[model samples]
Target: MNTTKRPIVTGIDGSGEALDAVRWAGRAARLRDVPLEIVHALDFPALLAGGVVPPPEEMKDTLRAHGQRYLRAAQEIAEAQGTTAVTTRLDPDRAAQALIEASRTAALVVVGSGGRGRLTGLLAGSVASAVGAHAACDVVVVRGDSWDDPEVADRPVVAGIDGSEPSARILAAAVAEARARKTRLVVVHASADEPRPETEPHLDPQAATEAGEQLLGELTGEHEAGGITVERVVVRGHPRRELIERSATAQLVVLGDRGRGGFPGLLLGSTGQALLHNAACPVYLVRTVS
Candidate 1:
């Protein structure tokens, strides 16, 4: 197939959460049979009095040294995870900006749910959220307490589908991830009843459910042919809430950067943001190239 060599890149700041991202990225790299790159951004803003002055050489050296240490630790973690093809980069730029640039040629870019400084937060770090929204390729934000556990590989890979334009890409990525981990695939579609016009005929709930089931089957048919176990769940409710609740026991939750219900003008959709912020597991955002 398309054999473009793109590495799995992960950002680290030496925090336990960052290291968790590195660990997850390492496993993903190994599963994809690709190289892994661990990056640490040295983002130090300076205050100046009407003039800009670069930091002293000693200060810059100290930051670089600390970054090197973090990279080394991350490298060790990746190696320990059996990912031998690993590299490290020390970026002198904002974490989100650096990661976004890296995503240009990366198969996937990963970051911890929260990190130090501007990267620290509740559901996801600021850098992680920004990168996830803007990255050219897929972005995975590692979350939950068990994110660092390699044993969680057995959990099913969950994907949210809306039968939208990006549904195929989302399903493909989810199926690939499930195949990589040798886990089952859980496909969920949240069907919310929309109000029809007064002159329009009422739609049957059973027909809608049947249509959803057929769509899921058609989308995952190729993967099923390859012996992938696929389960379809079509429920009536809000898509974001349903997906968030499903994330509780999932190894990873995959979704499009924007869905059919998303605002056309927004770069990232509300459903994606909700799942990113509240999902109990790592959330993978797949964006199809325009």
Candidate 2:
């Protein structure tokens, strides 16, 4: 067992989507040989005020029981996978806030796309988006029935790179995952500039490829030193569009929150936010701490 101090935290709300999140979290925890914490956040006041009027004591007991049920379900999945699993019931008034707080001690925080509410499928789900934007650790937003795809067990781990310092960490993490899974790692870099008018020369394709290859070489060399196999690719278009398109067939896509831009050292970047909302596969964001 890895015996890491922090466990992976998964959000559960008794919804089918949350159950799927639990399943994914269990598999991830087992693969990493780390502990798993199943979390259920409750907004008791909202629940009571939203039609179902229950006494304060009754509401407390009801929420507790519901949380226990969700936890038991998660525990069952973890037990079957032979992984350590724990549960936490939090009533922080706001679901996203509670989940983000829980993420402080989590290796990764997992959440479902949509839940049993009216705001389901509203672009990555509110809770998932919230945590993805603010969590200190990685966040995964699971969506779609394709979660059962067998390719998930054998697919390559894809990561986006732009020759940024934070990309070093992202590339390292991708290599670790690929090595652990005994799978291939794909490093993609998207570079696109506005096309010039008239007979103007193009941005030398050969030059672009060489530059991309050089960056890929550096990233691959670092991973190869650690015995990780990786393939490098360069695409021309919008970073978000290209990455999302590539993610359609990837098992996982790893990205850094910020890159070597003006404020390259920031925790969050525009390209990352775009990918988080649009990527098809589960997205992982690696933060570069200052």
C-alpha displacement of 215 in model 1, angstroms?
1.5
Top TM-score prediction, candidate number: 1
* lDDT by residue (tens digit), candidate 1, 162-251: 988889989999989898888999999877733445885665788778888888888988778776799989987788999889888899
> How displaced is residue 246 in candidate 1, in Å?
1.1
Q: What are the per-residue Cα lDDT tens digits for candidate 2 across 1-290?
A: 65656888887887887888888778788788788887777766566655677448877887788777877776787567667655555563667888888888788888887675627457667777777778878777775566458867677888888876677888888887787777889898876633345675556777877888888887688576566567888877666787888878787788886655526335467776777667777777776653
Q: How do the predictions measure up, each by TM-score? A: 0.91, 0.85
TM-score of 1: 0.91
User: Which residue runs does candidate 2 get wrong by more than 4 Å?
Assistant: 2-4, 45-55, 118-121, 193-204, 259-268
Local error of candidate 1 at residue 82 (angstroms): 0.7
Whole-model Cα lDDT per candidate? 0.85, 0.74
Name model 1 segments beyond 4 Å from true.
1-4, 44-51, 118-121, 149-151, 193-202
Backbone clash count for every predicted candidate, in the order shown: 0, 0
Which residue pairs show collisions in model 2? none
